[model samples]
Target chain A: MSLSVKHLLGIKELNLQDIEQIFQTADNFKKVLQRPIKKVPTLRDTTVANIFFENSTRTRLSFELAEKRLGADVVNFAASNSSVSKGETLIDTVNNILAMKVDMVVMRHSASGAPWFLAQHIDASIINAGDGINEHPTQALLDAFSMRERIGELKGKRITIIGDIMHSRVALSNIYCLAKLGAEVTVSGPPTLIPKHIASLGVKVEYNVKKALEWCDVANVLRIQLERQHKPLFSTLREYALYYGVNKSMLDSIKKKIVIMHPGPINRGVEINSDVADSKQSIILDQVENGVAIRMAVIYLLSGKREME
Target chain B: MKTLLNSGQLNITLQRLSHQLVENHLTFNDTVIIGIQPRGILLSDRIVKMVKKISGNQQLEYGKLDITFYRDDVASRDIQVPNDTNIPFSIEGKNVVLIDDVLHTGRTIRAAMDALLDFGRPKKVELLVLVDRRFSRELPVQPDYSGHTVDTILTQKVVVFWNEKDGKDEVILIDKL
Candidate 1:
């Protein structure tokens, strides 16, 4: 039922049926995850390489665990300790690993389109963990997975993605995924942080945070890219908090019980306040739990031996 | 095409199987009924209903398992949409009856057994099938209890319809044209 793609480069490449198929596969793996023994021998005959050029904790560990749980032999390689430190090209690094018989690769690189570039030249199936500000396909998959778990079918549901959109791979991937699934997606943040010509991608850009929150059934507050900022995007952190930070008082003002979501490493008091992030309506933890299942589905689907009916 | 068993014959076969289960396991304290997911669940549900009616007790443990991830031919065949697995209790030291609608290449049963071992080690595991498509098993596996055995060719397929969803219980064999 999956689309015939060797690499999961971005959500831009997936259609509605591919997304549905991955969700359906994730649903099967979710049942396996809940069992007393969460390991399956589906990929025992295969091996994987997790190559992370960017610093990450959650995505890396989730992919590693997902690969192991599927019974695949996994080898992790971070840029700092790998041949990349010696100035090796991306293709060279990946090809070296593939020479050892690695069947698949899960890569997280700082440059946008890095996974796509490697996928074209490499023999192994490439999964984009996060490719700079371009896309994080698995994150988007888990986000949609969590949303479907809480809100059921996404068709016609209003989803408001908040915070820094221009620098968020999560937002980009989510916009592609949610829009394709028939959801009315809107992006809101500082005017400068919002990308140019985003409306062409089929989403409304609302500058007012309150109006965006009011219009949405689910509000996904992404972490502001403090590290990626070279010049100040806003006047100050306090100024950003005043206009964008979602606090208890701000949330309490709204009568509707809206689901709150954040792609972690949450910057408390920056994009959203502590109370709101830890609130009963928050599904950050559920997103993390579903992350493993999403990665499992991605890996299982992209395995070299894709059997088509 | 030929009908191996119609509604009346199907019900009698399931009832007889349930009685045989009761005669062997007695109170069923150490027994658990597990159905292969998707189609086998309908047959398993019918069996559970018959057993509960005959014993006047609804305490027997029953569950459904999907073997999609455990299948040996996953990489070589079309990927199947997996159903749900709902086992609330452990199979440790228990007698397990693994049920399915048909016994084809015996691969499905083999995959089910592999999945079952992950939950816990059972004292023994048995197989029950509505249609035993003989002479085509690819593995060294056999059913302990069977409703009926059909002699089939390589080019033919066996389709089982149940009253629970198909409006009536029936088994029909078809040849590939």
Candidate 2:
């Protein structure tokens, strides 16, 4: 078998075998983490470009760390600091970067499918870090990996993704990966925010938080859309939190050994209660640690020398 | 006639197998061996042990995976304990060899691959089984490395027991009467 993956654009593009290959590769890199020297010369000659069109600290840092750990020369590009502010088109900017002969581009863009577009146009391998409200495949993969580490298996597990489902790329990606792994996933938010057609993708849509929480083994609390407040998406933050936030009282209602997860830049005291955010059940930190390993796995699997046998 | 492999034969086979694995340059710069539970994992442990004794690299990471949840038969019958699928190491950018005790219908390896993805990605994945019984395969799959290949009928069963289970390591050919 020959292993080759040039680009990691989305979760939907991966088959079961491709996903396993990434996981297995990531498993090998775990050794470098334990050693006193946590750097490898595997990708010593490769250059990785981190192009973030949106504001992100955690994701950007993790990608940077992963690239550096794997011995790839990393170049960070932020919209505010780059030529984009000078009215350069994305294609022009990408072309300018491509002229430098970078090996791979990890992009976080505000427009949905921007990475997909770049993947089609560019010669370099593209990895979608986050793309608008469409998908954050790597985050979803790390979350799946984290959950698998804790729960052992994904089949038949009830996973409740609670909060602003409509504007969440995390929710979309998680739903896709979880469903693919045989999990029974539920997406719950205010009726206005939960897309009606989302159920077609093998996910249950819930308007009531309590009902969804009652049956979940994993409660993935998503950050509410503070930016959507004045757009008539919902009435008020206080009301939404009162109805949907995973507070201590709501957390007490579930008897299963539940794990709490949040993709960070968390709006503490809002989407998740303060206590629960710091509780023993919280794997938010684990999600961050796993993010590096997951991205490392993705990069290594896609860029490593393929074995044809 | 009953075909049997004693404990000593099994050990010798394993040493030869490990030597062959090294000779093929299968131990790439970044590679991981993941054992399919429960017997496959034990086999992986022994392979890792032998690899360490030969090279002393200490970089070889091993993982144990339970493919029950990912099995196609899960929907058909009741499942017992879905044991821990632990790969404390990451698989990204590494060559992966999935170790197993015996290769039969290939369905188990297929299921193991499905279960393996929940962890992370690997550069490549190769199947390594102790015994490759050349029976009718339900799936288009074969082991990359095998201790031995035995041609068997559909009615025959290949049983491999370790000392941990049966006080010795041996292979048994049993007819389903």
Best candidate per TM-score, number?
1
Error of 2 at A52 (Å): 0.5
lDDT, candidate 2, B1-177, per-residue tens: 356577888898899877766665444458777899877877888888897777565777878887643555421343223345677877877788899998999988987876666566777888888889776688989888998788888898888877776777888888887
- List A-chain TM-scores for all predictions: 0.97, 0.95
Clashes of 2: 22
Question: iRMS values in order, in angstroms?
Answer: 2.5, 15.4
- Model 1 has an lDDT value of 0.89
Clash pairs (backbone) in predicted model 1: none
Which consecutive 10 residues in model 1 chain B have the weakest lDDT in total?
A: B73-82
Question: Model 2's CAPRI class?
Answer: incorrect
Kindly list the per-residue Cα lDDT of model 1 for residues A60-128, writing each as its tens digit: 999999999999999999999877878899888888999999888899999998988887797778899
Candidate 2 local lDDT, residue A268? 78
Q: Per-residue lDDT of A42-132 in model 2, one digit per residue for the tens?
A: 4666789999999898999999999998778999899998889889999899989979988789999989999988877877888999998
Candidate 2 lDDT score at position A256: 67
Error of model 2, residue B87, in angstroms: 14
